[model samples]
Target: MSLLETLEMLSYLVTIVGLPLAILTFVWEQRKERRNEEEEIFQRLSDEYREFLKLVLDNADLHLLRREGAQTELTDEQKERRLAIFGILISLFERAYLLVYEDEMDKQTRRMWQSWEDYMREWVRRADFRDALPGLLEGEDEEFTHYISQLMNEEQKVP
Candidate 1:
């Protein structure tokens, strides 16, 4: 073949080869970026799951101690300490629930919370444990009452 024809063929070959390599590089980079994003999502979820478990375990410990009447044998200061622990447990449970399920919580999450609610109900019904819970439930009742009253006031104002 003539030298000009050979050069033309070589140019065509380079374009075909270089175009695919460039496209392949772009696709590979996009795939890598997607993988990194998935890893970040998995890491965030793992951190959330760990926090949830910690809250559940802390609540269980505090609940069990109060249920067993271990506080009665201790001094008043010890009783206060136990109450503080119970308060911490409740606060942690509330915070974790809000973090994990801000708006649309899943069924498994609601089921987990329901289990905790039933346990709390049992605790509230126990005469010995009732005193331990008044602190946790007291502020909540007033908040609910205020919310209901505000709704009523707003309705009256409307009509």
Candidate 2:
């Protein structure tokens, strides 16, 4: 073959080989970027969940103290504080739900999410958590017990 023709054929081969490699590199980088984003989201959710659990536990502690025949009366101010904290807890749970059950979430994480939701609903129902904290808490010791168990389960995966 002529030298020019040979060179042209070699250039064609190079293009064919380089195209897929370039495409593969682009795909790999895209995947890595997505992975980094997902990791950041997971970490943020985990941290927020930990903080939420802490607040819930604190609320439970206050409830437990009152349940033990220790000053069960909650003033309006105290009730407002409890309501504020509980509302924040609910918001955290909603965020965590979105995080853990995001479109790409794996099966195990989805299962944990189902459990979390069920536990939250159960506690809310048993204690009528939507009602006035003072009156509900005075007679809702069992709900606190259930809450502790759910918190333990939720925190089990944390380091």
Candidate 3:
């Protein structure tokens, strides 16, 4: 073929192949970046949960970690502190539900969300936490209120 014709054919080949390849690569990179962002958010929330657990451990006298609650009646001051801790926990759970939970999640998103669900389930299993939930849920996100309430009901049914 003539030089000009050969050059024209190369351009056509790029238009047919390289253009679509570039578009696919761009889409793939965007998806990867989104997944990375989701992972980062999940990690930050996980760290916050760890910090909250430390708080719980620090107040071991309150027996907040116990499934049945404190063995004896708490002093007025301890009751106040325990209520405050429960408030903090409910706030964290609300944030996690708002940020992570979704009605239509991909497999990876669902997997990340499951850990948070388990945490909620564990806390809800505690009788004290369940008792405090209604007061703590006041003025929180509506969807989160509904979600956790459902979880509380489900946990209550478990033996």
> TM-scores across all candidates?
0.38, 0.55, 0.94
| Candidate 1 wrong stretches, greater than 4 Å | 1-68, 100-106, 125-128, 137-159
In candidate 3, where is summed lDDT lowest over 10 consecutive residues? 62-71
Best by TM-score: 3
lDDT score at residue 80, model 3, on the 0-100 scale: 93
lDDT digits (tens) for residues 128-153 of candidate 2: 24353344334334545454445545
Residues 3-109 of candidate 3: C-alpha lDDT, one tens digit per residue: 99999999999999999999999999999999999999999999999999999999999998887889999999999999999999999999999888999999999
lDDT of 1 by residue, 1-159 (tens): 999999999989989998899999999999789656644644565565456556545655334434445543566665665576556545544443443332454564565455444434444444444455455645554543343334334444543
Worst 10 residues of 2 by lDDT: 61-70
lDDT of 2: 0.58
- Candidate 3 Cα misplacement greater than 4 A, ranges: none
Question: In candidate 2, which residue ranges exceed 4 Å CA deviation?
Answer: 1-3, 56-61, 64-73, 99-159
TM-score of 1: 0.38
Q: Residue 41 in candidate 3 has what lDDT? A: 95
Pick the lDDT winner: 3
